[model samples]
Target: MIDTSMGLKDMSKRDILVNVAVLIGFIILCMGGGGIMGAITRNDFGDRSEWYKALIKPSFNPPNFLFGIVWPILYLLMAIAAFAVWTKTGLTKEPIPLVIFFIQLALNFIWTLIFGKAKDLLASLVEIIILWLFILLTIKKFWKVNRGAALCLAPYLAWVTLAVALNYKYWELNPNMKPDYSWFVLKTEL
Candidate 1:
């Protein structure tokens, strides 16, 4: 009986580890997807020095550096929420909610490509609205599986709402500011 109990405990521990590993992998995938999409869409690559600084931002805008800090934590939370749903219902069973989560994530990456790389502020704003809608749907579906998972998405949704407003404000302030590809060239001699 003691040996059986030990086996059960070990199995449970293994299950926990597997769940944690899956969650971390999902988060990393989301981050990597966004990074690659951003890199591919941007012509100038690492040269945000010119475009970002030249834009007229609202006084309420948070420092650009703050975005770097906030998104990783939010993405981790999003992954945890997704993992919680996956573990609760198994991956194949929760198709609708899982699809919603993926749709929102795709939109999240697309928004960066649209606004940051393409410099289409209006299109980005529209895309963010779609993202917000999908996020709401994901939250609702997650709530059905696990309330904690639903709650985990709250910060991400809030941040995106703030981002939408910021995008609009930037568009309003810099109506004519289109991204120029020439600004991306480095000064190094060939």
Candidate 2:
């Protein structure tokens, strides 16, 4: 008997292959979208700021190189997680998970802008906390339709946890360093 639970109750091997190919194509599209966003974030923000370099980071803080490595991997995992959920529910059946996923991803970009571009540790802390909650919501939404998709987000959650701590510590350690980023300051920074 075909596995209806998988939503793959179909006819021929050729059909299955084509369906899998389509799914793969979708996953690739998601990855590409994610990559483009990441590249834009990287190019726009482009490395640790002078303010960031001057901060008194906690000993627990990972190196700049580590973030460079982790973020791309996390982005890939996010794409895979979304792909898994899409395979289960499709665009019509339930779209909330995908919407939440995209929201969290956008929040991810915002956090980078606050932390990396503005160098506003306090604002970044707040934004990252919001991002963290969105990630939890996305994972919960994914869990309802696909457990593996939820599991894929675990690393992203963990990394954000580290970021929360780092943001808090930097804010705490260098009260002198918090840049007042008004619209004027933002324009100057840009």
For each candidate, how many residue pairs have backbone atoms clashing (under 3 Å)?
A: 0, 0
Tens-place lDDT per residue, model 2, 85-189, is 876777677888988888888888777666765668788889999999999999999999889989999999999999899889989998887554452353545
Best by TM-score: 1
* Regions of candidate 1 where Cα sits further than 4 Å from its true position: 1-21, 35-47, 179-190
Work out the TM-score per prediction: 0.80, 0.77
Weakest lDDT window of 10 consecutive positions for candidate 1? 1-10
Residue 127's lDDT within candidate 2 is 93
Candidate with the greatest lDDT versus the true structure = 1
lDDT by residue for model 1 (7-67), tens: 4456666676776687777788777775676466544222364666777889989976687
